[model samples]
Target: MFKKPLHTLKTSAPLRSSDRRKLKQRVIDAFTLDPELGDALVPEGILTIKFNTHLDEPGVAYLSPEASADPLWFSLGKGSEELIPSVYTLWKRPDLLPFLSTPPAVIPILVGGADLMIPGVVHHPSDLKEGQLVAVCQYTHRSKNGATLSVPLAVGRMAVAGDRIQDGEKGKAVFVLHVWKDFLWDMGGKPQDMPEQRPLAALVDQPESEAAEGDEEIPVDKLTITAQPAYTPAEISTLLQASLLQALSTKIPASAFPLSASVFYETYILLFRPAFPHSVLPPGAGTENSSDIGPGNPQNITIKSSAHKSLTAFLKAMDKAGLLTSKTAPKQNELLVTAVVDERHPSVAAHRGFVTLGEVEARAAKKAVNEEKKREKEEEGGRRVEVRELCKASGRTIGWVEGVGGSPKTLYEPTELRTLLNAYITDKGLVNPREQAYVNVGLDPLLLGAVVTPPKKGVPQKEVEFMKRDEVMKGLLDGMQAWYEVRVGGREVVLKKGALKPIRVEVKMRQGRKACTLVSGFEAFGEGVVDAEEMSEELRKICAGATSVSPRVGGPTGTVEVLVQGKQAKVVVDYLTEKRGVPKKWVEVVDLVGGKK
Candidate 1:
């Protein structure tokens, strides 16, 4: 079983031109023998870089293609100057396959991020020493011939010498850095399954023919020196029984009553002929001249007529043995199966039980639940909770109110209300075509009186155009009643916002024990024609401190806020309203200059 990764990741500053050059140089030096691998992994079009401090040495991830949000290469430093590929990178790039090798049974455990056990390793060169980069592969057998060994499951790692692995040590043989389907693989979005493994030396030398050259035709004589004995009747029977059970579990559903044996055999059972060819295949199965049947289609490997006759006979035999109930045709070409083979059937009782459709479904369901639980635990540290808050203007629909810093769910600050109003206007298409900056109240009467105050005694206009955007936003918020959203576990209740405090500027302690001021309601100020970067820079200079902008997960783009250094809440609010032209009504000083709001 796999355990959740303990390390957390945060977005780091984008690499400058100078830093990119330095990173490329380091990669080139580390992979001196394989220059193309170094280039493909850390391409020039990288978008972002993230740092992981959890490992023995710090890890750096390089994302590329300028548009992709996920990293293509995750590199870990063995010491100061040398670097090795992480397991994640190896899964995607098979060109590095010459480095490491392992056996088949160790693949699942490696995908779960477990260390490679010494006992499971089949082969590695004696020249392979500790601290070298390597690739791990499963000793897979050819699909058509089990005697010929092939390497299909490829992973990457730091190397440990063969002598050390043979020391009978109980610890890990290879320290697994990453794996397929782990948290890092799923970081930006759903990752595709790792590519099928290819020959190690060929992939390293010829990149273009890797896919076409995956399977090599090896003669059976080369696979074994001694002649093999023919399978006995009992062995053939066991193989057929296992194949029958597998086909039943995968193709038949519990609710599919009175199934047709002819359709089942044609679709499901025939597909297994390649796996159990010697036991399940009908006599002279592939001897037919099926070339005239169709174009671009290979000859039928299993003769349909013979397979149908044999399948009907097999079903009837099972029915007589009381494994299932079946109705057979006179020509033995079809059968109607009624019920599944009961688990308590005497014939299969010794082999645990007959596998019914219900049992197969239960096992599938259990697997889904375990995967969901694992994903939830991986995201446990950062939870996105939405609160139901009534829009002061349109109380008919509940608006989503999200948590900021540490605050109770009540009342919408003027800035937060502004974001909601803009969203409503966009959603309703209420903007006048003639005047893009003005709202067209004719689309919805509620948006007129509720969203903005009625025209004043001397005013003649009735829409958003007459007033500034801030004035219209303020008027709408003042006209509506406040509401509160209370949440407990999975249940949420909404009530009127009575005597609830508004939003404010709060200072929080971040990494390195630095005090940073968090301004929550500035979301609306960054929208439309507003310049977020210019505003952030101004705040930094005004407060004489460093500043950064971080978007709240699952929150609107309008809610992306700024973080300023030290205790500058009071100063920030004054600057926002007076210097930046934000209205004072939209700015609230709910918290003290140096404390929590």
Candidate 2:
């Protein structure tokens, strides 16, 4: 169903703590998962995406937990909200979902948006029922070290019931929905490596070719040459141990020791691990590239194998061996690759060298620097808000507005439009004599069009037309083109279609008599107009109280909320208009606490 781009109906901010806990509990119940594994499967925060599928069916998916992840789960059809773990989620814990294995030749067909037929199924769980969700993969996903990995390539629903498998069947077995390289996978910011595959000739009569049935081979000139080192001994545990010693002795210097364990592992260990060649090769961007898999080109490796269970365990083992010092950091208890590397240790001194180790270390150092810069850039950058701009002044509204030298092309701020309407009403002497706050709607032709409907045909008016001044003003503005202006430092971007959102300033009671003022909706004005941290610091000084800025959950995406101690709604409003030059009309002040602020 997600073979095409789904139209997003709405997207929610991160789930609140209470809601998140409830979701976790629900997952544990549905998947029959252990509490710890279930918790790890769910991210700290999830973005709820409600969308319309290709078939117009409503669907939802939970996206990235932190920042650099993919959609965690999605569901469609009758069980729309029944979260189905995405390929990304399944990669970490493939046992969480039931899967059907097909021959390797059939995988290329499934990746091309084809549903899995009953003939293609080589293996499936006995407990599977019709309409049950399943991961689609191949038997050839076996690693070189003689381990079969349950890596999923696509997700789909079972068309045939599990109980009816004894009887010979044909047609669709799994109704293919989402594929590995489909648009949904592209939502994630991080790139993923496709699992390796090998030919399996056991499925319903098909050729043993790598490409799908009836597929043509491309010209030799079109193929990119990917050269790589031939497969050596496939014992991963041994390779990892050797790579760890090499990385510590060569890549990480004595001065660089005592580093965060995660940093050292990410920067050094992974880069130095021996590469394992496979039939389905990963892109050799940072490593070496050639058409043939031979000597001189050191390829990449995998951490998903069973040999490596956890980094902490591996580091501790090395520490026990007296080759390095690994200990929990003070206070935080985080593992630290300490500054006590045994350079003269037997393992370090007797380590053999590889041809591309130097090239690999250089790349790793460059990558670490680049990643740090990227992280800083992401933190420093702010979010932008986009709203629709509505209709503009035209026809009768323009004709009357032209008397004041206004033109059809002129763009006025919302406040300016309200002021202009009030001036027109006052100039025409249309105020109700009996009520100071009321305006006689029938007193002017423009008011008749804007605020009053003319008598239908021969119908007579039953009562004198009148409306509250604010209501009358609202009618006039509605007839004219709607406008919302954004003031971002010294620049402005006036878009069309969406109504403007005001800067919301609200005050609420906290601990007994204590109160705090909350500010939001600054995205409409842009970050340049008011940096959250800067505004918080400014408020701290002006109000002589504590203030802070933080990202707001359950609101707009990427919204940063500002908070100040005490009931400072009035002060916040004044500061916005006076100091930031935010229009008076764009500041919405609400005081839940009784009395004036």
Local error of candidate 2 at 380, Å? 47
Model 1 clash pairs are: 99-135, 100-135
lDDT winner: 2
Task: Give the alpha carbon lDDT tens digit for every residue of 1-597 in model 2.
Answer: 555455445755787778777778878888887778667877677677667653346777777766754877877765645778777777776556566775555665665556776645655655578999888876542233322333787888888786444324645678877877776777775465654442322222235483354223333332111234433323334555666776666645678777887787666765565432232223333332222222322222333332455667777877887777888978998999886455476788887654333353354334434443453344233212233344467554665667655777887665676777678778888888889898877666655665443468889855547789888656656666665555332235444445777888988897898899999987766544556876887899999999988887578788889999998898998888766666677788888887433
**Local distance difference test scores for all models:** 0.49, 0.62
Estimate, for each residue in 333-447, the C-alpha lDDT of model 1 and write its tens digit: 5678776664444444444223332233233334434544454445332222223444343341222222112123345655676676678777877677776776666556555
- Work out the TM-score per prediction: 0.36, 0.34
RMSD of each: 23.0, 18.0
| lDDT, candidate 1, at 176 | 60
